[model samples]
Target chain A: MNATLVFARKEALEIVRTWRIWVLPAIILFFAITAPVLARFTPEIVGAVAGDQLGGISLPPGTYLDAYGQWIKNLSQITLFALIIIYGGIISTETSSGTAILVLTKPMSRGAFVAVKAIIHSVFLAVLTVIGTLATWGLTAAVFGHAPADPVWSSALIWLLLGVFYIALMTFFSVLIPSAVGAAGAGMGAFVLLTIGALWKPLSDHSPAGLAGQAAALAAGKPVPDLLWPVLVSLATAAVLVAAASLLFRQKEL
Target chain B: MSAAIRAAGLTKSYGRKLVLDSLDLDVEEGSIFGFLGPNGAGKTTTLRLTTGLARPTKGSIQVLGHDARAAGNAVRSAIGYLPDVPAFYEWMTAPEFLSFAGGLFGMSGSALHDRTSMLLDLAGLTDVQTKIGGYSRGMKQRLGIAQALINAPRLLLLDEPTSALDPMGRKGVLDMIASLRGRTTVFFSTHILSDVERVCDTVAILDRGRMVAQAPIDELKARYGKEKVVVEVTENADELAKEFGERPWATAIARGALGSIEITVTDLGAAQHDIPAIVAARDSGLARLEAGEIGLEEVFVELVGGGR
Candidate 1:
């Protein structure tokens, strides 16, 4: 337990020192604020730039849901990409560069090494989600004149859960592959397959990728049908991914 | 004293290529034992087996009386290993890296504090607060030693610790290793014969994945090394070489260019007694006559067969 905590602290420090703290959350926050701002001002900006081209083509007034939809869409895509970019090499780099050998020799279990990496990445994901959420909420409230707290909270939290799942999936693939780019490729490949599986009705609400797809409806206060199954499935899958990662990492040669 | 590490019929193969043949080794507790071998002589493989970082394919290993392959693998806690090229997090300061390493070994608070400080001072890295990424190779190697000693392990395994360092850096690292002579069983491998001579009490010379010799440094020299006798006479040098060659005691004799006679003697006492009498009888002025000197480099060269 102590080894795990120590390794976890090291991983957290790595994330902070490497600018993941600034880059991931800052990018997410940038999108969080800009998404709504872009949605609220699209009409005026278009009118100013291409007024003659769009002569008298009136646009609808941006509602609370429009800003909410923009936030969810931007976050679901950009934040997902950011997550992949941020943590893609978390485990693979250590293994490849021979850094893990020194640490592994010191009475630290391989399970602790992998588990701490997953846990710390999850913690960073949680922090990014909370900060992004608050920043988006404030920007949306300022633009739309009203904040739809409940649905935005639901959507952001759900997406954030999916982010944790991505961390696990990346860790699992990173162990399976030997390099950061290869690991990210493996993860993105599996992610695409999972997204495709979300289209099947039986798996649509239970697939790990289904949560991200339902974010728009989740943020619009529209009842997202069968939300419980997807959340449960995503968490269970993440747990299994982390477990598999630990097992594979234990067997890996330094 | 119990052996710090023991291996019987230990064999390891990667795919079909055998890296370590069926080999036996023993390291006694509380000795600065040098594991000497040429590169690719399975020295690293042996260290890996002892540390439980790797498993042997065809034999058993006992480290600190525990089966290293068996459950729990707690024996690793008592070991501090510095790989040939030890790398670090590259983002951590020396003290922070030590604290993190200490925590892994369940050391914390002031106990960890004092140990880290002492080790850093020992490694001579206390003043440098730069992250490990900016450290030079020597600095990193020193820090590597510090972290390895963080847990105060009973056995320290270093793989070619001086393989790639300047003389100053190697001396510093060797001095630090020397300080742990009694407290830790230092089993380090190096191809450099001088290094083993400088610090090791006992040595095991390995060749082609097989151990050629393992004994106390002096004993190994006595067993495999022949005592050399150099006689520089004003005359009758070649005649004495021929005479000594035919004698029962001289195993080999080589006459040098400068009226010098070199002889490898089986009986040092007889040769020393006989040499002066021969020089005195010949009326040859003896400038220098030195006997009973054995060079470790000769024994190492004999064991490994010429690849330094």
Candidate 2:
């Protein structure tokens, strides 16, 4: 009934009817099905490739931990890249293409437009992440004969929180940059800075960037130092980014 | 009638280039107002400013009696705007797009449904189930108007609504605007003078970002328009044109329709009296003689210095 919800429904339909529904889901699903397979057969494949180089040496057997670890690696690198690229044009494209003019000329506020986009896209990524994590959990159990759901689920959920931060960050960049390509480029640059920031102890333990290391450690069934600060910071950062995006979009000329 | 839109000292500049310069405009609440101009004459800029899509550099614009920039979305509910090249969710069908547009205005249930159906019928897209992406230029232009009317907005701002359509498409859009004459205040901008001539009751001509002329369609034509005397001779029409050019009453002369010579006159009565004498002296048979008012095109050319 709310105007924001109405516009959000239109945006959701756009994702469903356009190529957007397939691209990110397909990428995450590709990792979900193949990460476990790759984790299981990688040792054998390596041994075969080095057949004559080794003198009857055998590699260690892969485990469910390795499967989950592979999944986390793919998510942090490949899936995160896809998410940034997919959402980079979320706000910029609408304004540049003149679609925003028509909608904003109605009763809907510019802030409502940006807020709806951020909420819908973040929720979309969250849902897909959950589905992908469940798929990986089921496939990991099948490949390794046994798998713990708690560590895998917790790790994937934390990584998803970090992914939501990127979605908000991309929304902000899209508002600041009018060109979709420029927005995506700025998002990548920020990702690089965040990745570098993860190396510092305080930043890693206190910021969203730290979630990556925490996610990998959790996937390996290892104990983490502090999950509260990183989780809180990532969520807070996402909220701040979305708010800033809304503020900037209010002044944006369509 | 009260003013539907009012702008005073409205100006817009993109960096160093000034797009609009101190434009002041007023549109009556129930008139189909046409904003006529040449290409890049800042017609679209004025529309954007009035719709609150772009802010004025050094002026104020009030829409529906509210300050457009300050009120923002609060004022927009009473206004519907269509940009020059309207973009839509290409995946949405005509009805779906209209429904989406209506939903934004908080319309729903039977109200939204009926409005969507009526607009689709008006646009002649009621049965066209194809998505907007597959629509032709004309179909898209008509659908653009349909979405803008979904809320029954009091003041509709259209920026070059029919600039990119064929004759039939232009006619369809003009007829739709004409149908809204008494129901709403239509402020449509276009360089097509004939479109303004066809459907607009009042018009303002803009040249180089300034308001050159503004009045009722008839008043603007009469104030700035030249009177014409058209004469068709059986032979030597060009010679008769030359002879008419030499007269004191003829301000300008050109070739008229059907091998006739059109003489633009300072005094219609003098030109009427002298044309037959000139034709008879040239020994040319006068097949036809007609005196009439000049069209908006001639008036636009007189004021703006060129045709669209």
Candidate 3:
């Protein structure tokens, strides 16, 4: 087997055997099971809390659309935050802990090391996103009596691309910073910058910043103004980040 | 014999601080070469440079006749390296980690399985069946050596392999290295002089990022190591040591245990013949006088001027 394939297998096994299996998967599954439940019961719960003091206001009845919105919101915010934290130490920890020296001294290239990590984690995020989306869809039908698969699938795919972008982004930071905590800080700062960048029209339309909004709009069955540019630019930027990380990691002293 | 590793003017620096300065070296094929140095003496830096894990700031290194930096996987595939502190995935057992290491070298199926099994037994972890995180420091060191050998590399670079091990653990690691004699060229770096003297055929002493001395173990002891005459007296041991320090043949003298004075000498014959006369002249009862064999520790201290 090639070094990349071998290392990728080790990384996959690591994800299953370590604490890594618990954190993000737990967060994704938790949101998948709870998002539709919360969307269905919120109206009745709010009405019960303010029974006599309705103040001439009436709460709207929950529906399947509300479940999709809740699912997209959680995926974009809570789940994305967890993903950033989980991948914070991806490359940096291996080097700092001296495991890279053991493997890199073999026939493996530094580029292979970085690429294997990016690919594995991106695949992991995609798998979790697919499973979570399916869970939300199934439970939404059980709770709201109707579930639209197209809206959920399209939105989840968009969010999955955004998640892949973050994986590459975090890999770049992990290579740039030697300390895991420091790398995570840089990743969060980039996230804040991306969120702020989304406020600008050009960045919103052409970069990863646009994916979150498009995902929410898609979940509500609304037509997006544009999607191709954002998707293309996001995937390209992700490739650039991973390539840059490999270059930087090669120069890094083990 | 052909050289397994050859370097010229090799240097490394972290910013303004130089870790290894212009080191030139060679290791004959199939020889266990000991890289001896004190802490912070750049032994690890030299090993890292040779392994291609860290690039040198200047000069070049050739491992198994290939440029370490430019040869990439070609050179790497032929070399195995164990860092001073080897780290493993805490979730992995010993066999799993060894198999992972072998896989990186393109070993598979029965070959990988047999290698992992042999390494696990060599590391004494075959039946332990515990995750790496649960292992002691000594167990981890043994496992580190095992993983490094997974590729059956032509050259094995070990940095301070026994620094953190206990007596039995140290003996175990030394036994493993000795068992590899003539099979692979072992570049072992350590501050433990005894370990080098025990298993290494040749040794190099490094101090403050420079090569001080490099030679065969016995040759180094004979060339730089000073012979000592241990003299014991019934009284006035300190005064006798002071007197011995003034003699023409004595280069250095120190008070030894049991009221004895050890005199380092340029000529063992002169010291043996003259020492008794001096003790009798001082009127102290001479109890014991014997010549002490020079060890690597004394040679290392002579070259580096201090113990680790």
My TM-score estimates for the predictions, one after another, are: 0.91, 0.97, 0.95
Model 2, residue A193: what's the lDDT? 93
TM-score of chain B of each: 0.85, 0.95, 0.94
Indicate which candidate wins on DockQ.
Answer: 3
What is the fnat of model 1 with respect to the true interface contacts? 0.70
Candidate DockQ scores, in order? 0.58, 0.81, 0.84
Superposed model 2: Cα runs more than 4 Å off: B306-308
Residue-level error in angstroms, candidate 1, position A169: 0.5
Model 1 scores a C-alpha lDDT of 0.83
Name the lDDT value of residue B84 in candidate 2: 89
**Residue pairs clashing, model 3:** none
lDDT of 2 at B157: 90
lDDT of 1 by residue, B23-132 (tens): 88889999999998888999988887777678888988888888876525377678888988888888889999999988888888889999999999988888997888
Residue A238: error of model 1 in Å? 0.4
- TM-score rank order: 2, 3, 1
lDDT of 2 by residue, B185-241 (tens): 999999888889999999999998888988999998889888888888988888778
> Worst lDDT window (10 residues) for model 3 chain A?
A78-87
- The list of candidate 1 runs beyond 4 A from truth reads B71-73, B231-287, B306-308
